[model samples]
Target chain A: MSKSNNVYKDAFNRCLRLLDETKSLPSEPELGTLLGVSRTTVRSILARMEETGLIDWNKRNKTVLRAPRSEDFFPEEETDSLAEIIERSFMRRLLAGGAEAGMQINELELAREIGVGTTSVREFLIRFSRFGLIEKRRNSHWVLKGFTRAFALELTEIREIFELRSAAAFAALPEDSAVWADLDRLELEHRQLASEIATRFNEFSELDERFHRLIHRASHNRFIVDFYDVIAMIFHYHYQWNKAEERQRNEVAIQEHLAYIAALKSRDPGKVDAACRKHLKSARQTLLTSIPEGRQMQPA
Target chain B: MSKSNNVYKDAFNRCLRLLDETKSLPSEPELGTLLGVSRTTVRSILARMEETGLIDWNKRNKTVLRAPRSEDFFPEEETDSLAEIIERSFMRRLLAGGAEAGMQINELELAREIGVGTTSVREFLIRFSRFGLIEKRRNSHWVLKGFTRAFALELTEIREIFELRSAAAFAALPEDSAVWADLDRLELEHRQLASEIATRFNEFSELDERFHRLIHRASHNRFIVDFYDVIAMIFHYHYQWNKAEERQRNEVAIQEHLAYIAALKSRDPGKVDAACRKHLKSARQTLLTSIPEGRQMQPA
Candidate 1:
């Protein structure tokens, strides 16, 4: 698969949603604009729709035949880009608890396992190495540094430093800065999530990332903004690996976020600092508790 | 062409320095231990030395023939790893004033230009992306973010944050920690360089990196420790690009480092904070001034 055809597949899925809202498709150029794709892609989608009898195509006219059924849509996994596929596979192995520190990671083996080219595996490793979980050995393979307690501590340590500074910066943003409105939006989401925490707890992982990322962006420092990737990855995996008490944990976190948002809105650095620290401290604890005791020992 | 033979060439260069002080080569095992290579590599070194008449080799015995000439060593460029060579080449283009912000970087073109495999070039870009000077566009090429004023400011902002925290951590380290000895050794080197500032100012760039890196390591956070790479790269290229007041600037930086070192020794947080801020402020100013005014405009 050259480039995975994810762009076409994902766009086709989105185009199905559009079909449900209209009697007939718009002009090819207009549909291309709406789908954020090229004319070629739009034509391809129309061709596929006509072939599947989902639409009747007669020059300049595309009439919907029926609403797209669940079976009519492409499989959910087919729409993921190759990089995302590789990342999900790689992270699964890493967080699966069998990965040991100092284990050599073979690009060839990973490529074979993932059914992708070596170049893609190599590129994925290079990109993933920034998380500090894997490192390239000189003239050799990459080494797994393991997701140990020390790794969690190191990650949270930087996260706290960055988030604390960013929180203060967020509080100091000018009244007219667009981020205040963003904070308000996030604040509303936090409230909504808090009310439905019992059922919607799983969704907090993503919201947590966006909320912290917004504050980090306030620093207007690319490095600070970029460092969120590390925190996000760890939490993304942590949330998946340790599901026990997740609902309660997320519920408490939602409340903390509301407080944190209120502090940012108050534009009081002291309150922001306190709220941010309170939330981060609990987050660090949650991450630390998730690592298995056996894996927590320092690597020899 | 395969793996660059840099490990062997660089090791051979170090072996020559060892040969200069010894009459006969040590046992192959001993030589391997000292050179941090396998016996296979040690044998290759012996074979090359014997072929070049730099040594006389007999079974189980090898003797130095004459002092290794300058030509006996590999070319300085040949001793660099492929990644280093690619980075230098890439940065030269980036800092050469022709690389516009938002310009696309083609890996295949870069590989051909640098006379390396595309894999190496791709890997270098992935590693370099963490510095925030470049970003990978979805499903396409990497885009140059440029070394503009915003880049410098953002870099120094995190550098200051990380370094201050690390400096405080360094001061709080127990007396038994190994960093105290390292600091003393660096201080001695700083003093030596200070005395020879007129002639040795160029060397301060390397020392500056080591000094700051030592402090960064004290944080015991890999993210903080790894972040020094960004600061180091910017300064490495910045030092090469800006030549005005090089000697005087290094002289002042050396004094600031000494004061910073002294404050760390005193374990006075207030003094350390003041010294670190003072040095960083000047350092930031120096970096900001180096970017040509024309390149500092925000990308439209």
Candidate 2:
């Protein structure tokens, strides 16, 4: 890897962890402290956010922190990259949830803490807020809203719903050029995500999330993504059970993910549908195993 | 109604509308404007909140917003009333989104146009954020995170997970235990909600969401309620399509809701499950009807 690439990866991980820890925006000093990066390097990264065009900050100034409020971050150039945005969005929320309580975090503070900049923190924050987990205050400190039981239940239900939704997207794929290209792109993402999970030793919960997200994106129905996000949320929240409960199921997941990619590569929709179901089932089992007294039928 | 009670209810709706309008915490002036009451009257409401200890206000005697980090506003006692919170939270998100987009708004905002001063909104925000839809900002403005795709998927999946969750809760109820007592308590609330929807009902999408929430509360599980909330978000985001695209399914949903209460009081678990599933299926079908275009096979 190039030296710059290695540095960027390190910066990215630092940002994710800081978000998890603080659930707020981090400032420049905090980023420098966390990533061991100079402010200059951090600012450069923030500047490159022009690619996503998500955050707002004076290009010449160093201190103002702002978020994208419908200013061209909508992905109009529009490749099948919504999946990537979704994936990135999920990571931001996870990190935000894990943020430490009562830590006075600001956009700059978050940027510093996460080794990014005020800009990315603002962009990520806007996206995170869009998902309704992180709320910004009048004074600019981050607070955690946490999840409701209803939301959790709704999220779990999405896995079931996605099966139906993916069926729709799958059917549409043959006739819709956008849908076909979306799957092909997602297949590549799944490969990269899978490789990171297997070879690079990624976080299991995140890897699992990305895997399913790949399926969701392939479904290619806009609502399919929003609609299925909660299921992913349920799975993510109960991820405490992932490594501990699904010890044996890791092998199953590997095969499921691979099967999905192979099918997508082959443009075999049947295989995609079947493999996705199997993957979701395995994911469900992992969640079930984590709960004491697994699910059973009783005449209510 | 007693004058105080009428006043309280009126104030409550005002706050609710404010919550319906803004996702951010309201300033004192905003709250007064939303309530249509003098700033003094709003202060009285805030004082009552502070006195009851349900909310801790900013100690500085400013507009008496929610205490920055107090757990009191979202007391554990109210967790079981999950549906109430879920409804308010969605309303709050809708309000905020509408406000942001500058469209489809009523003149009177809910309570403070910042803080709904309603327990449900607070609880819902906390819970939903935990699940990743609602997030807190640095300045403590509650940001309405977009979980449309994820949330819609959750609503569908939840209809299945909750049947099990509710069934488990029902089984846990001892035959002589006051499950009926709980129902009796919920009866009035349910009727009030149903009547409100039935009377002025215009939008199928909103009515559909309202029905699911009523049933979620009726099931009486805080944990399950939270799960249902995640699902409700799914409904909120996707019900638009389900209503607009699948008119027949919408009609079916209207008919099902027509008798939902009777089915619950029938006191048969299977009946309730069947009813709930049937109700959910109609709604699901409405949503799913649009999904098959991309599906790989004919949906069974």
Candidate 3:
């Protein structure tokens, strides 16, 4: 198949939510601006809505027939782009075992197995190569450098370095900088999550990423900001595959984040460093413990 | 054309040097092993050598007829892989001016200009995106982020962080570690280049990369190791574009590197940090100064 219609599908899902607040859809141009798509894409969205009897469209008029049901929205999986699909498939194979170090990755075979073209597979591999889990060979296929303890250690090593520097930078931000406001909001979220830990602990992963990302952004360095993608990807998969003790792990993390946030608010580098170090140390341990026993390398 | 015959051309050049050492060519398998190519490639190299009158071959025996001349080797440009060619072409466009931030990059237009397939251009963009100099728009083309002062500052910020950590790690490595030996070798090269600074200052860029990379490798973190690519790319162009006081600047840098190397050998974290920071600060200043005046941003 060609590139997935994820843009349209995802936009269509968001448009359905907008319909609940009004009887008639706004003008096409307004809707186009609201949905952040071109006029052509907006028209396609309207056509799909009309076909499903969710709206009545005429050149400039679109009337919502009723509230959209759950079925009206595209499946969550279908809304993901082809690159995301390939990455998920590839990562699953990587974390599911049998993907050993130095194993050759065949581009054509992976494309066929994923039911996508080789170009898409090749592009995905190129993009994913940044995570350091796979490598391209000269005049040959890619290689799988297994997700071993060494990989985790190396990842956290950089994460700690970056996050610490970012945290210090965050603390040094002027009082009026917008990041202070963002820190306030995240602090509140951490408290809420901590209070509702029994039921909302699973949600900490997303909040955790946002909190760290906010701190990383304060460094005002694109490389530091971009480096988060690697940390986020590893944690994304780490959270998915290693679910054991996740709630407890997240609970402890929430408290650490609260302290970390408070330390940043204090605008003292020492407190920020200590708070960031404490949280990162625990995080490094959590990641280290998740690596499979067989793949764990002895510490140097 | 498909992938350039770079692998063959480069291997052929290396083979020429080997032919000078021996009167007769080695067995095909032995030649393949030595050149790090397959037997097929080895045979092809032999065929080219014989056809060019550099060697006489008959069944099991192949004898060198005459020393290979300069004309026997492929042009230096012809030996660069398609990706390298495309990157050089693209970076030239980026650094040559008129590449404003927020400008859309047309893959087809770039491919046409570079005389390569769109696939190669697309792959290059995907790979280059990690450098944060360009961004991919959803369902559209890549956007040039421009090589502005902001970009330079952001780059050097991470460079300082990673290098400082790496230097400390280098100092901490046990005496038996192979990296200490590597560091010693680089130190000797640095001294050799320093003594010949008048004629060899131009070569300092390559040695600078090697010395820093050796320190980075000690971090044993692939992310830290791989990050040197961004630093190298920017400096590679910076050295080419900004040549004012070139010899003097490299002379000072050579001295800084010597001091840094001495600190690493001393194996003291305090000394290492001081030496690394001193060198990195000068490097950062050099990079910041190289960014065009128009693209430089006021300090926030």
For each candidate in turn, the interface RMSD (Å) is 1.0, 10.4, 0.8
lDDT of 2 by residue, B1-300 (tens): 211233444464345334333334366677767665566667776666667543456743433343334333243333223334445545545533333321322212433453344433443344445444455543125655443434345546646666544643553455577555655555454444445554434455565555455555545644455556556565554544333434545555556755554566676676666766776666665555544442221112
Report the candidate with higher TM-score, 1 versus 3.
Answer: 3
Clashing pairs in 1: none
Query: Could you give the CAPRI-style class of model 2?
Result: incorrect
TM-score of chain B of 2: 0.41
Q: What is the DockQ of each candidate?
A: 0.80, 0.06, 0.85
| Worst-scoring 10-residue span by lDDT in model 1 chain A | A291-300
Task: Give the winner by lDDT: 2 or 3.
Answer: 3
**Model 3 segments more than 4 A misplaced:** A69-71, A294-300, B292-300
Q: lDDT winner among the candidates?
A: 1
Quality of candidate 1's docking, in CAPRI categories? Answer: high
Displacement of the residue A176 alpha carbon in candidate 1, Å: 2.5
Collision pairs in model 3: none
Across B1-300, the per-residue lDDT of candidate 1 in tens digits comes to: 466677888889999999889899999999988988778888899999999999999987788899999989899888898989999998878766578888999999999999999889988888899999899876578998887888888898888988999999999999999999999999999999999998999999999999999999998988888888888887777787788899999999999999999999999999999999999999999888777675742211
Candidate 3 lDDT over A1-300, as tens digits, reads 445678899889999999999999998889888988877888899999999999999977899998999999999888888888899898878777778898999999999999989999999999999999899977778998888888888888788888888898888888889988888888888888889999988898999899889999987888888889989998888888788888899988988888998898888899999999999999999888877576732211
Better structure of 1 and 3 per DockQ: 3
For candidate 2, lDDT tens digit of each residue in A1-300? Answer: 211244444464444334334323456666666776667656655565434443343644333233434442323333223324444544554444443323344666545554454544554455455444456663237665444433334444545655645644554455556655665665566566555554543354566566556557755444456545545554554554234524335545766767766665565667756766777666665554444342221111
How many pairs of residues collide in model 1? Answer: 0
